[model samples]
Target: MIKDIDKSDVIGPKSIDSPFLGSIPVERLSGGVKTLILMNNDSEHIFNASACGDNCAKWILKIAEKKDLIIRLGYLMDFGKDEFDIEIVNIGKTVHNSLELAETVLDNHLI
Candidate 1:
């Protein structure tokens, strides 16, 4: 959690319905910006794209529910380096806040 952000700043794990059927649990990742964690297949992936607000999280989850779609999205996003099996995890919009970005990576763990 960031110092200035209170619990009210956080949303979901409730608000955004499960987009991948009953699989992925979406929640607000800690930061002043609107970031999210999408969990599925026993793994957690971060989501913070320019188009990816809380609602976009659900849309991404819905589109990439299948393995093939995940792979395609990863390639399109140029996530050519990471070894994660689920490539959809590599998709990102844009960082809304750099401080929150750091906190998300350093402090938050969706897993």
Candidate 2:
């Protein structure tokens, strides 16, 4: 996540080496990474996934593969072109890809 989202390297347990910002504490990471970390580690609450950008979608799906993840998105998040099984809790519909998800959201005014 540090490398992918921040373009930095994890130098230690609590430090990251960022080319733009130099060394910084883990707390100084982007909100998207922080949110992803919370979602990955915590299973007790639903996260507002809109805090994440499209770049974070793959990581979100990866986290879902490890556990049941429930998240709320204020807008449609492009989960790339790959096939994925994601249930729209609002309509109780399971969509397999971006097209299906778009259709479901449009048909139901979910977005």
Best by lDDT: 2
Residue 29 error, candidate 2, Å = 0.6
User: What lDDT does each candidate get?
Assistant: 0.32, 0.91
Q: Candidate 2: lDDT over CA atoms?
A: 0.91
TM-score of 1: 0.22
Model 2, backbone clash pairs (residues 3+ apart or across chains), number: 0
Which candidate achieves the best TM-score against the true structure? 2
> RMSD, each candidate, Å?
14.7, 1.1
Give, for candidate 1, the lowest lDDT window spanning 10 residues.
71-80
Clashing pairs in 2: none
TM-score of each: 0.22, 0.93
Give per-residue CA lDDT, model 1, range 6-26, as digits (tens).
Answer: 233323444432323333223
lDDT of 2 at 103: 89
Candidate 2, RMSD to the unseen true structure: 1.1
